[model samples]
Target: MRRMPTRAKVEMAAYGASAAALAVVPSMEVLPAHAAAAAISGGSLWWLYRKAKTGDFARTIRSAQRLLGPVTGGVVYAAAAAAPGRPWWEIAVALGWGGVMAAWLPVTRSTWTPPAETGGPGYPPGFTGLVMRLWDDAEVAPGTWLEDIEQTVSPEHPDFTADVVALAGKPVPRLSDVDIAAAFGVPTACVTLADKPGHGPGRLRLTVAPTRRRGGGIEEVWAEVVARPGGAIPGSKIVHVKTFPAQGDLPARGMVLAEVEPGEVARINHEQLCSAFGVKAEELRLVAQSRGREALVTLYESAPLKGARRATRELLTLDAYGRYTIGTAHDGTDAKVHMQSAAGTFHGFLVGVTGSGKTVALALMCAAWALAGLANWVTSARPDAQMTAVGRHVDRQGAGAIFTWWMLKAAIALMDIRGRINGEVGHDFSGHSPYPGLVLVLDEFNSLVGDEALGDEIAQMTDVLAREGRKFGIGIVFAGQSLNLSKLGGEASLRDQVQGGIGVVLRIASASGGIAARQATGGLAGDVDIAEIPDRFNASMSLMDRMHGTVDDVPGETTQGVGHTVTGSEAVMMRTLYVHLPKDGSPDGLGEIFPEGGGINTLTEREIQELTELGLWHDWTMPPPSAGGDSGDAMPAFTGVEAGGGIGTLAPPPVAVKAKKATVKEQVLAVVDREMTAKEIRGLVDAAAGTVRNALSDLVTDGKLRQVDHGVYAPVHAPADV
Candidate 1:
């Protein structure tokens, strides 16, 4: 009395009709019953076999039924034919065959179908599934290679187990961040993530879409809960997914999903992303952005410092990025330097250990200023130190501190005088100033700031200068082996001010292996990591190519100047220019002052001509600073090139001397009777970039004169005020 399936009911009805036909029509008995039985059996077998092809159900039984149907029908015919009128035998065979069909009937069912594969990777089965994947050699798929195994493999191959690795331990078709996110029971777009400074993982609105099974076509997803990772991403909370159109280079337009909230992207950094994808450390770039924590990422084809650039006059203005570049970030864009503010209110702090290119940094910045028609006021406690190079191009030497109180007094006097001039003229000059701004390069800050006798005064001077020199168009740049807030001076702390200041900190280091890596990059310390640099002791191929298109253009170990600026909270590696300074002896004995193989090298004939044309190069043999070196006509640079060909070979240039008996400083001090200014004394002495200012300063230190006001100095005999 049970209701049968539709197919069963139809077949049953047909069977009854057929029975009725045979019984009702005696003449139909002439129509063979065996033939009718054979037709019915063939149709049933064909239909059942088609059902077997679609799903896993009674496969063996279907074939048996196909064979049995014909055999039983034939048997029925045989019994009827062999013994005519023994129709009971044929009836018994037919009933038995029908009973067997009922016992062997199978139901239709669908098997597991996996979802589509994603670019990141797919969710793989667990360890149990891995063990089950082994197959015999014959059953292995063609052209499929087992990873990490050099040869073809079969299931549970003995040799494979012994020799195979996980291909650098990265699992293929394994659960990835994308897969895990998708498995969160929602449709989500998985964003690839990595850790990086400046631009890295940050807040992003990701549309989370659950991933469907691989190879599953048009199948409904989210039918089951997604399997989450054994360990969740730290601090991440599940958010509802959002569907979007195809964006950027995402895999599909089908269901662009965002699975996380904004700011979630920020948490994913270069390291995390690399580990997740099993890629190398540098494959991704979190390039510095003009604004925002979300910087644009780009892949670089090659090293950013692959080439070198020289400092040129055209690169002198604010329109350009820096006084000179240190190098480039991993991303090939210029690591443009921002040394100080427009008002010269800030200072540049170059922090690096010895051999890390501190001197190179100094020269690069100074050279840029010198080339731009800006003044370079450099100083070193040591006269013969490498810091002397920048002063070579200037009319007067820019070095020599001597770790004495006199040194501090001279600096204070110099800055005080310049500060007053800036106050009078104001910082808003249209064209350039005779001294556009003072770039006071302190070579050994520790030496001066840590000096036993003058350390405190020097420190105080540093703070005073930093506090007040900016509006007066003067900026300070400190470089030394040892640096810290205590060495910087001032009662209140300036550590935060310097660290979180408006200046570029060129963080430098060069250790290929070990702990340097751990301490290599971080906030304010190393925002950018400088990869391998061209030899600082030699000219690089890029430099050569830039000059002559061949190594022969400018050969030898030309010093390299490389670093990274942690300005604006972002780090960018940079390669500063190889500045060209006059050779051996310029007016201030400034030429050839940097380390033999440092940021500033001796000017070649071609470079000398270029700077000479701009009137930036000095012809030392023509006159000394005490003479008319600052105001008189300069001889061609060629005339000053030493005959020995130390950067040049030429005869000495012409010169003129006043033949005055008094020393230059003597004349300057004599004129300070009624509070004479540097320029007034210079005119009285008839000298240029003359020794007057220093003479006045020295006389004050010697108690022979007093700094009455600003640049004016009064002799001991003068009035109290002037």
Candidate 2:
């Protein structure tokens, strides 16, 4: 025979004693009736005490009911045996005893008890059990009473029914998981509850205890009870279960994890995390650590550009986890952008300082994204046409045309030198399909976007992107020297919109603190220091791959390695010259001036002079013509003839001169050209007062001209030069 446990043995002994006391009660009831009745009552009292000790109230009630039936029958029989003389009194006494026995039996069976209705003091079924289990298992110590309770009554227990109604009569507090997690010493990984359903009755709460460490310190343990979907447990089953802190031990920095409802993960991945939060994989660590399991995840999947494998490799090598990548090369000669579906995507803050090679890197990435058909480039700068010659193959017709045309129009629109907006600025791009993946790359982004009015517009635009862009495949890339929460409209909005950021510190007095610094250094202080960055060194080469949860330190030298640098003037000249000249002089004007065909060259003297004379070249003038040779040789000269005069008129004058040398009045007559303005002719002719008056009168009389003003005059006939 096996030995029973101590508690079980005690219960058995109590049961045996209760049974023996009840057995003799009926037999003794007939002798000395009053004494017998007292004895029987005493025995019943003893049995009741024993039953209570055994904690078997249900069994005790059943035994009492069985004993009542026989006792009542015996009472009736006794009344008959003792009723020979005084029959009426005897009958009444016997009837009263029988009724008393009947009443007592029912009372014993029906009295209320705690154990049958509820699960004693420990467990309650339905809502009560669910709430209790949530509380009890919340932060159990390794060997504590609560741990034992957890083992006995859990959500998976045989009698476990998650009806929250048990907590209906109890007072419970309402709190978010995050708050509960904070109150407790545990990492956020353990909270698994959801918000309460609209009509649900119970509150969700979490409890945590610090985990004991080997060094005598303690880490936190966590637990929580959340409103689950569906009805109560045992009846309702959990469709999907997720555990957070995907990576168990948190790094020195921190960690973040998320759980998604069955089919809901995809939406969260695309819109909330990727487009709204702009979270790259690397950035997830910080978010996880800070926000914990309750943090919402919204991110999207992205790919590298097609045909840009080399450029992608180079970019990855430089900034391994950076959000940006170099796409298809313009000329198909250098690194061609290859779109890889595995590249992933993010939305977040971006930082690029001066001399950080950010411009080139950005251009390269934009080109790649555009080429891969993943993003449409919306910028106020033209795609450098020279890119076509750089060994990167490009399609002039496909999406490339959209990029080229839009960029060209933007460049023309922003030009300040022409003093007037050009017609090219109005060129229509509405014909092209509205780009679903539109990414506005604002270079020197702060200049236009930082203004109060423009900032508001940008903020609104960002809001739209954060809220609705994912649906339309629209995104934004903002690059600048500094990014602060205020500059981005607000900290919360910026945090939500920008999931990934790249910081390139090319020597600045100060940098945005916290996350900004981490962005530059890849979360490693030694890897970069924005304030101490060397003149030519860019500390922001580290790629904050928020999508991958990594930081790729791409040295400045490496990312900028294959790119060329041209001064502003040089670039301008190259563009202008190459478009007019050719290498072999077949006379595609764009090719000749730029033999290397980059379209940059110096203008010749003759061309300069011609342009100057036309009023087209204002910034420069023609060089002096060379000495000696015939300067006017290139012009056609005029040849002419003269008419013979006066010889025919001389004969009549000789004789007449001798006869009359008579005195003549000899009045000086001054002819004034009155039609012309006096101011105009004042410096051309001289006259005395009276003499000029007579000449004017004579000229007027002769109908030569007339005065238009007091001193003005008009010509009677057409002038020499009109």
lDDT of 1 at 19: 39
Q: Which residue window of length 10 is worst by lDDT in model 2?
A: 569-578
lDDT string, candidate 1, 1-722, tens digits:
23345565554444444434333232234556656665666666676677677776666565554455354544444445556454544555555555554444434321223334324223235322232233212222222222222101111111111111123334222224444333233333322222222422222112222222331111112111111232112233322222222223221111111132355432223333223222233322212221122322222222234345654444433444334444444444455665454443446666555555566556666655554445555666566435554555542444333333332333344443444445667653223543455556666676666654445555666676665555545556666543544545452334333433233333235454112322432122323322323344233344446678553555544224545565534445555554543335444322333233333323235433544543335422222212125654643333232356321221221233344478767777666668667677777885556356666677789887778779877778777764
The residue-by-residue lDDT of candidate 2 on 1-722, one tens digit each, is 23334544444443344333333333343557545545565666566667768878788776666455444444444445444544455545545554454334354433423333343246655434544554445533211111111211112222111212224444334435564344333455433333235534344312232222221110111111111232111111122222221122211211113333433321112112221222232222111101111322111121111111323323322233223333322122223222221212223223445543444454444444443344333342223333223213221211122232222222221121111112334421121323223344554444444433234434444444443333333345554554433444454544434433322232232444233444542232211212122232232333545556776556433222122111110100000000221123243321211122232222235433533443333321221112223545322211111122211111111111112232111221122323454444434446455444565556546766554546555555634333
| After superposition, candidate 1 runs with Cα above 4 Å error | 1-292, 295-302, 316-326, 381-385, 395-408, 418-435, 489-560, 579-722
**Alpha-carbon runs more than 4 Å astray in model 2:** 1-348, 380-436, 452-455, 484-490, 500-532, 536-722
The C-alpha local distance difference test score for the whole of candidate 2 amounts to 0.32
Q: Return the lDDT, model 1, position 170.
A: 42
Candidate 1 — worst ten consecutive residues by lDDT sum?
150-159
